[model samples]
Target chain A: MEKTGADGFDGFVTARWSALFHLARLLCGGDRHRAEDLLQEALVKLWFAWPKVADEAPEAYVRKIMGRAAARSARRRWWGERPVDRLPELAQTGDMSAAVAERSRLETALAQLTPRQRAAVVLRYYQDLSEKQVAAVLGVPVGTARSHASRGVARLRQILADVIDPVG
Target chain B: MDHFEQELARMMRDSQEYIPFASEQRERLREGVRARRRLRAATVAGGSVLLVAGLTAGLFLLPKGPAVDRPQGPLTRPGTSSSSSPAPSTSSPAVSPTQSHAPGTPTGTGTTGGSSPPSTFPSGSVDPTTFPPNPPATTATAPATSTVAQGTRTARPPVSSPPAGSHSSG
Candidate 1:
C-alpha cells in the first residue's frame, strides 16, 4: 500500500535522462559506464521518493543524488597491498582516441583526491552550489565544507600544474 | 560579499559538462517499484489469517468474557467459577484472575506475585502496556495544533506521512 516509488516516474526519467547522465558523467570524470550506473542508482532512490520531489525542482534533487553517487564511486578498490581507489588499472576503450586520452588524464587527477574532496570540488565547481548549500548537501559544517573546496582546488591545481598554470 | 566566495563561484563556471541519455534508464525505475508492492501484499494477508484464528479459540474456551463483564454472584459461589477456570489456568498465565482476587490476598499482581496493590490501578486500567501507546508523557508531546496536516508528518528523518489508508484505532 506504500506508494514510495512514483507511478510512471520512468517517463519523467526518460525526459530528464540526458541531463542526469551528463551530471553523473561529470562527477564520474566522464566514465560512461560508471556514469550510467550512478545515474541509475540515484534515479532509483529519487523514483522511490518521486511523489515528494514531484512538487519540488526535480533537477536539484537529482543533482544532490548524483553528488551522493559520485562520492560512493570514488570509494571503491582493486588488487591488494597498495590501495587503489583511483582506477589507473583499467584499459581504455572508445572510438575517439584524443578525447578518451584527455578524459583519462582528468580521471586520474580527480581520483587522487578522496571522494569528499572530489565531491566538494565537483559540486562547488561543476554543480555550482554555494559553500553553505554545499555544506548542507555534504552534511558537514560550513567551515569543514569550505576547507574541502579550498583543499580540493589546491590539490587539483598541484596535479594540473603543468597544463593549466594560471595557479602558478 | 566576499572575494574568495566570488572567486570560487567563478572557478565553478569554468567546468560544466552535460552528457545526455534519455530513453534507456527510466524503464528500470518502474520495474523496481512493482517488485516492492508485491512483497507488501503478501505480508498483510499472512498476518490477517493468524489474527482471526486466535479470536475464534478465545471465544470457544473462555465463555465468561471477563470477571468484570459478567456480574460476581455466580462466580462468588463456592464451586461454579472454579470448575470452569481449570483448563485456562493450564493454558496461560492470565487464566487465574479469580484465584488471585481472593479476600485477604497478600499480593496484587497474582501471577507475577508482586507487592504492588491491584487497587493501584483503577478497576479496569491495570498495566502500562494496556494503556494506549501515548501515555500522559507522550500525550502532551503529540501534535496538538488544530491545523496539523492530515496524515502528513513534519519534515524530519523519523517523521513520515502515515500510510495512505492507515487509520489509528484510537
Candidate 2:
C-alpha cells in the first residue's frame, strides 16, 4: 500500500541498524571504514527504492543491497579482475599466544582475499550460514560458493599455519 | 565443525563490538539519502535542458522551401499610377504599332493588372504618316523621353499635309 515519505524508513533504520551494520562489516572483512561507506551507500539506494519495496521484508531487501554494494565496490577496487596474489607470505618470528596470533593472522589474511572469496568465507563460517544460504548471499551457484569457501579456508590455513598449528 | 571454522566464528563474534549503530551512524544515513535526492534532481534537470536544446536546433536546421518560388521586383498596388504617366492617353489618334505589341507590356487598363510598360523604345524603322498633331505633353516628358523625342525630331512637321498616297510608309 503506497508507503509514503521517509518516516517508516527512519523507523526501520533505527530498529535494524545494528544488524545491518554488522552484516556490512562482515561482508567487507571487518574494515570498519569500508563497511561504513558500504552501509551508507546501501541506505541511499534503499531510500530511492523505499516506495517500490511493496510487501517484502525490508531487512532482506536492505541486506541484498548491502551485499551488492560490497560486490560492486570490490569490482571497482580491483578493476573487475581479481588480484593474482592476495597474500604474499612474510618471514618473521615472534613469541605470542595461539589465540592472539591466530586472530591477527586471520585479520591480515582476510584483507588479502578477493572480495567474493572473503564474502563467501564470512557468510559460511563466521555467520554460520549453510552453503546454499552463502550462495544466495553472494549470488553464485552452490558449487561456486563452496569452491570460494574451500579456497579461502585453504589460503587462511596456509598463511596461519605457524600460529594455528605450529607442529603440523 | 572443523577446528579452523570454530576459531573463525569465535573471532567474528569478538569483533562484533567494533561497529555499533549510534547517532552518528543515523546522521550519516540521513546525509546519504539527501545527497542521493539531490543527484536525482540534477540528472532530471540536465536531461530536460538537453531535450529542449535538441528540439530547437532541429527546428532551425531543417531545410526551407526552394528559393526560386519567391516573388521578385517591386509589387504593384491596385490603385497606384503606372508607367510614370499622370493621365491616360485617350486623345492620341495615331498609336505607334510597336507600342501596342511591346513584348512585356500589359493589354488591360487597370492600375495593377497590367505588366510594366517598356522603359526603352524599340530601335526600328519609323513611319512618318502616323504622327499625331497633338501628342500628350506628359508622354514626351517621361523618363524614357529620349527615344520618343528622337522619333518626333526626325519627323518633318511640313509633311503633315502630304497627299494621302504620297506618304511613303516604311
> What TM-score results for chain B in every one of the models?
0.27, 0.34
Count of clashing residue pairs in every prediction: 4, 0
lDDT by candidate, in order shown: 0.55, 0.61
The superposed Cα distance between candidate 1 and the true structure at residue B124, in angstroms, equals 40
Compose the digit string of candidate 1's lDDT tens values, residues B74-140.
3343212333333222223442333323332312223123212223322322322333332345436
How well is each residue in A21-125 modelled by candidate 1, as lDDT tens digits? 655766765567777777776776676577788768777888888776566654476201233544466455666565455555566666577677777887787
Candidate 2 displacement at residue A93 in angstroms: 16
TM-score of 1: 0.50
Q: Candidate 1: which stretches are off by over 4 Å? A: A1-12, A72-101, B1-22, B35-170
> What is the DockQ score of candidate 2, to 2 decimals?
0.36
Each candidate's fnat, in order?
Answer: 0.33, 0.48
Evaluated at residue A26, the lDDT of candidate 2 is 71
> Each candidate's TM vs. the true structure?
0.50, 0.55
- What C-alpha lDDT, on a 0 to 100 scale, does residue B96 get in candidate 1? 36
